[model samples]
Target chain A: MQENKHIIELKYLSKYYKGSNVPAIDNINLNIDKGEIYGLLGPNGAGKTTTISILCGLFGPTSGNVFIDGMEFQHSAEKIKSIIGVVPQEIALYPSLTAKENLTFFGHLYGLKGKHLKTRIDECLELFGLEKNANRRIKTFSGGMKRRINLIAGILHKPKIIYLDEPTVGIDVQSRKVILEHLKNINKEGTTIIYTSHYMEEAENFCSRVAIIDKGKILTEGKPKELITAKGEYTDLESIFLNITGRALRDE
Target chain B: MLRLLSSIYKELLVLIRDRAGLAILFIMPLVLILIMTVIQDATFRTVKEVNISMILVNNDKDSLGEAISEGLYASDFFQIVEEINGEKITEENAKELVARGDYKIGIIIPERATEAIRGNVNALINKSFKSFNIPGVKKRTKKSTIDITIYIDPATSNSFKNMVMSSLKEFTSQLEIEMFFKNFSEAMAQLMPDQKPIKFDSFETIRYKEVYASTTENEILPNSVQHNVPAWTMFAMFFIVLPLAGNIIKERDDGSAFRLKTMPGSFVTVMFSKIFVFLGVSFVQFILMLLVGVYIMPALGLPQLEIGPHKIALAVMALSSGLAATGYGVAIGTIATTHEQAATFGAVSIIIFAALGGIWVPVYVMPHTIRIISQFSPLHWGLNGFYDIFLRGGDLMVVLAEAGKLLTFFVIMLGVAIVYNNYNKTK
Candidate 1:
């Protein structure tokens, strides 16, 4: 089922950082398909960021291969980058700029310009309910506003696949709802979604399929309902997650 | 094309948003230039009269000696402090006083000096009677025992020494001329033998106008206060703009820059656009400084600068050097890891360049090794360009060498920045 339907494939992907005691990310195999919200669920230090950063073409893997839309990382870095959008763990908006200006800048970075760029920015601002505060500086904005703008910056290019790293980490409930709703709409519109989060309930409802990972390796993965039902006597996705990834807190 | 637009657009947006950083970068330099100009104007005053207080040791007890001392004391030029008569003046005390700059001129008079000027009866008779063996003529009677010493102090007063010397020479010449005329009249009356002692009443009054010439090329000194202040103003502007160019690097470290890097355009295009922005900033800083120098300063007793076409050329050459240096500074700033490091590097490097380039001091006066070191600094070129304009009144051709050096610095620094960025991205 994974091999026939997958749009993104990672095969024997292993990363051993320079002069490190152990691999930052161990051998991991996974597949993500188009029009599906796939969640990589993990606690802290689970190599979630490393995996996302590598897939974004920041660097190459120590060994094995990562294929995006069947194009290998070795040859099609630029093409893959063009088709993919990344919303980083950090709020990547410039604090000095107005909310609208941040989006405009990001929009232009995605090759959207002139009146077309201006229209796209206004649309995104309206969509995020930030139309009134478009002219306000980002530094003066609330965390939720910055988070929304950060999300908007990544999606302005309208890539086929979007990768979001803990987009709701510090956002308010209302802002989180807006972000997940936007992600749902994007996924519905034929864009494959790859997300990482510590929130179990959000992954349970929002993600079509989920994988529990710990210590840089995947423990289990399946459709949320299927994983919950298959694990005997589990009432919800959290019970399934707790039984698999454990209840222990990860500390640096 | 789209990628280039995005890169440039992102840079413009960030620059606009970061007002605090931009303000410090732009207006702070202007304010600093203004403050420094005021301070430098205060410290570097025009070279004028050196005042010396001299103790006049007059031993001439006669009326004539008294008149000489009184004349010198009464004059508006010589500042004379009369010493109380006690012991004879010694060379040791005189040297100490002169070395300390306590006095301008020291006068020593030997005892029994009044007898030297007296014309003896025998001397007069020898001239009248045509006799070789007159008592006063034959006996070398009382060899004029006049020993006088005038110790002039060079440190305390250059002009005061000249003033006192002029007064002394004038007094002696006037007394000799009067004596010579008195003797001539007597001789004429004796020759005529019948005519009453020639009573020719004639008055010849010559009018002399006093002129105080301001050195005017006669003195081969350093440039007058007029040229040096403006030259330094330009230098200060160049240095003050150096630290602000690190915005490029600051943005890069902050993540928004990475977002821009991945924008649809070439990275080099974006870098070049930032260079243009900083160049504009440098231009504004230069103009503001020049305005203060050319208009506001001369009104306050600084040099009257009448700039011609050559001055404009030199100014442009200076501006070009500033642009090149600014370009280099921006490149260096981007290569740095943090804003603090970038700022520190920018400031320290500019200061080093300023020192090496003879902005702090003239290269001509620097040692050979230091002068050789100055060739590596863009600041030297900038200052030299300024010198060519205001000091030498030189054309573009005169500043071409300096401009070329600045261009080379710009190229090297820019090349290093480009290489560093490429290497850093992978790291």
Candidate 2:
């Protein structure tokens, strides 16, 4: 593999939130190659969101180096932001704006304009089976529709890398299928995907490579089938995850 | 530039769709301006148009009593009421009316006041003739002074009481001078009977004139419209905080702000866009308020607002004021954690600034300490700028200092917001 093949490099990434003794993410290291569907799987308070947030440059880690597309965040934040998209755990969209309007706004922020922006928005809407509701406000949308629109807003600029945090946590099965299938198509187009989710089975099937993280550290990291095979007693990724992270409650 | 324009467009769209917020941004200020202007106009008219009612008891019923009575009636400031309920008012009754607050002032002429004045004048003239060694001059009687009592309501302001007392003194001084001339002429006629008797009319040596100080040739007196128009307009402009801050809190809560933060440009771009949109709203609110003062108020029997001749200065002041108000809104929105906190603090803080800014009453009338505190309020700077143009007939140079203060306040508030936002992101 070429030196530039790895699109994202997280070297000793650690984060300690203000006024808290415990680190949210401690000395975590990962290198995500281009065109890979990578899942950061864990339970609540498992540092999955923290690692994703750092990768998306929503904030910087306390002591770490994050290199996105061979560029550092501090020196090339704007340049890095242009090539990446972020879909937060929340449905981050203006309820008053229509689906097309929301996509247009996000597209503008990403420096897309005119016919190109309009064309991209139309294509995304059609691909998501939401072309008919393009002019309808998000407030009038269903949970699944809103989630789809939120996803579209992030991907409108066709960024080279995308970070999705719980993208389909609360949605109908059909909407989830449509979203995951579209994500797969994007990933096939050489876009790197960094995803976080609590669904063990979804992660096992969707991610090309998976890392099960807990207590601010990764417990295991490998291809889903390989990880399951490595644990001979566990038949699937769900059993493997339970065996590694334990049944202890992490509700805090 | 494209980023800025697009962000501004997005903010405008979001603001337009929030109909309730739009109404609060526009109609609340409009109604407040109209209602407050009307209410204040009534109070202003009472002070400007109506006369202070006073009861007068003329016990002398002679020249001194008649002269004072005529003087009070001649002035437009006083409404003399000699008889109440069809009964002639006595000195005791006059005092009782004034003490009861039925009358703001009362004047009583002592019995034989005219005779006393005449006797004093005649004695002085006789003594002057005797000094000249003229024989047959009557023996000079002892000079006597008459005391005229004035009763004032305890509630009457000391300044108003002084004005009434000064007017009464003028009447008595004129009467005394005329009596002196008459008595001197009588003494001269008695000395030389052959000379034809000369007659004279009452004359004034000096006259007093009152004028409002202003730079322009035509000075606009401070009236309710002139005052309330700009006062409440500044108030309304600052009131933009409620909707502006509320919208920011909403964006933060809905996660759109976080999404924007992750976009291509700086989040400052979005903040600038919000400031521009809300600044436009404040300008609209200001113009509507001025229109109400100019057109609506006159129709409702109040004096039309005089915006003065410094149109350019007024626009500059308005722009600075709008910027300051929007900056404050952004600061509050950035600092507050929730919509409830933002809305409550934004509204209450603006109201406090308004009160201190002389929106309810002019700073000149406020207590000394409050007046000093008022200077710190951006609304006060804006109001002073408006007042300089409207009441003082000042130009751009005259209002520049106030405009500068408002602009400085804007910069400080914007800086605070930026710093607080940056701090929040790091934490």
Candidate 3:
């Protein structure tokens, strides 16, 4: 109420899917500041995707208020969407389309067009080291190239907030490094990055502040180093994660 | 606006790249129109131009048999075969030929059929003279009833049998009337002895003239090309459901749909883009089908498809039908959970609708229940709209009635898709 400076704020958020007795995400509160890299780490079925989905405005929470850049989703849905870019875990680009074509199409969805859209597409392809393969169909690309193109599509409109779900999953070291490097550069440009990952070490090093979430509840939230130091006998974020969420199988 | 256009352009690019989908969209329908037109052309000719074969055994080579043979020969409907293997066909042989399906009908005139008819007429005339108490009127006994046996193939349709029977009845009635008039004139001359014989001219009191029921001055008769062109075109237009629905399912499965949901503006932009693109595909399909109907069908020795002068009506009908098909595809895509489900249901459902809509067979020939159900099919409405223009010479107002139904179907299907999509999301 006192002019909250955070770029994103979630208040008592919960989601109970239809016909399910358990809530996917229950009574969660979170705050992500501008230009900060925030990682949400969780085990399988731990509600990471659900929380991200709600934040992306993919679906409304069962009971909660979501505010993005000081505006509520109810009143500023389009405005919020325009400012937020989403890179889903899946290779979201059309397989039959060339990398440039896929990028141009996504750019147009964000209202970018003509020479501007073309120039942006070319720049992204060049930065991703995919300029040579820009004309190649996505179906013809390797998994890493596809993942890179997927990332480029999300950031083509130069959004202020980027929500990435497992963006580095199932990709090679070279593609992952290039992607993380570019994402860091984008963050340096004052874009708030909210990312989810199963990689604990990566999250520990990459995220400025992190939240360990499981069973629809946030277990802890703080800077990675501070969190590591506070939790005695745990050397790194992986041990901290295993200790908190446990090593038991969450086959779901 | 740019988003819609860009999305439409994207969908077109994707569609153009899919060779299999392109073939299903263009080649399948063109080949279907050609093949179906060629196949149905024969059936149509059977009704219009081709003659039905009949076996004739004339035991009485007198007036009745000669008259019947001459009448059958004169009419263009029948090709009478009087012999087989250079041997005269007997009554039993004619029946066997008809029963074995070698011919559609067989006619056998009984022996002395003309004499029997003459004797009966003479007896009736003598009885009339006796009733009037004319002098020297001799009483005469009526002859046995003359039976002209007709053998009809069991496989022949009842309607065809009725037509053949009616034609035969007309011939026999004329012959009987002629015989009666001749006998009466002879008896009158004998009774009067001084009066000249009266000559009766064969003049039909009422004549039947066949013409197509149409609104235009120049009527285009319904033929195979006219029927198959629009029927299969509508079928092909609706067949867009397969590729369109498959595209949607692929987007959802691959997560592009989710990404789109997270994009600027509403997802309706994307759905509308698909609709716009696929609707254009449907139009292209319709046009190609018409071209095949007009040119290719005629080249294949089938009657030319006569699309009436109502160009605006035809365009309106095509647009509405295309929209309806696209809308259905979207609805199926939204409702189905997987590509297999969408493709199978889309294809089977379109075929079912086409069948019900009289694509495979005309609605008039369908059973009462199916015919009633056909009224509900979008293809039926589209086919009727085309028929109204092509065959019935209907104006814009008449086609609008059908186009309105098709557009309503489009709106309803779109609404269902939207509602289902939202429901799935919320759930």
Which candidate number would show the highest lDDT if scored against the true structure? 3
Task: List model 2 lDDT by residue over B131-236, tens digit each.
Answer: 8888534635557989999998999877678888898998998898898888777777788899986777766667788888998897898888887888888888
Tens-digit per-residue lDDT, B119-179, candidate 1: 4322344465465432223422333435567877675345445666677767655554554
Candidate 3 residue pairs in clash (backbone atoms < 3 Å): none
Q: Which stretches of candidate 3 lie over 4 Å from their true place?
A: A1-4, B134-143, B355-374
Q: After superposition, how far is residue B224 of candidate 1 from its true place, in Å?
A: 5.7
Best by DockQ: 3
lDDT of 3 by residue, A25-98 (tens): 98999989999999999999999999989888888899988889888877878988999999999999899999
* Clash pairs, model 1 backbone: B3-B264, B3-B265, B4-B265
Task: Compute the interface RMSD for each candidate structure.
Answer: 2.9, 1.3, 1.0
lDDT of 3: 0.89
TM-scores of the models, in the order given: 0.72, 0.86, 0.93
Q: Ten consecutive residues with minimal summed lDDT in candidate 3 chain A? A: A1-10
- Quick one: ranking by DockQ, best first? 3, 2, 1
* Residue A97 lDDT in candidate 1: 76
lDDT of 2 by residue, A5-114 (tens): 57999889899999998999989899988999999988889898788877878888999888898888788888888999999878999889889888888888889899
Better of 1 and 3 by TM-score: 3
List the RMSD of every prediction in angstroms: 8.7, 3.9, 2.6
Give the runs in model 1 whose Cα sits over 4 Å from its true position: A1-6, A11-22, A27-29, A70-78, A212-216, A226-252, B1-23, B38-246, B304-307, B311-319
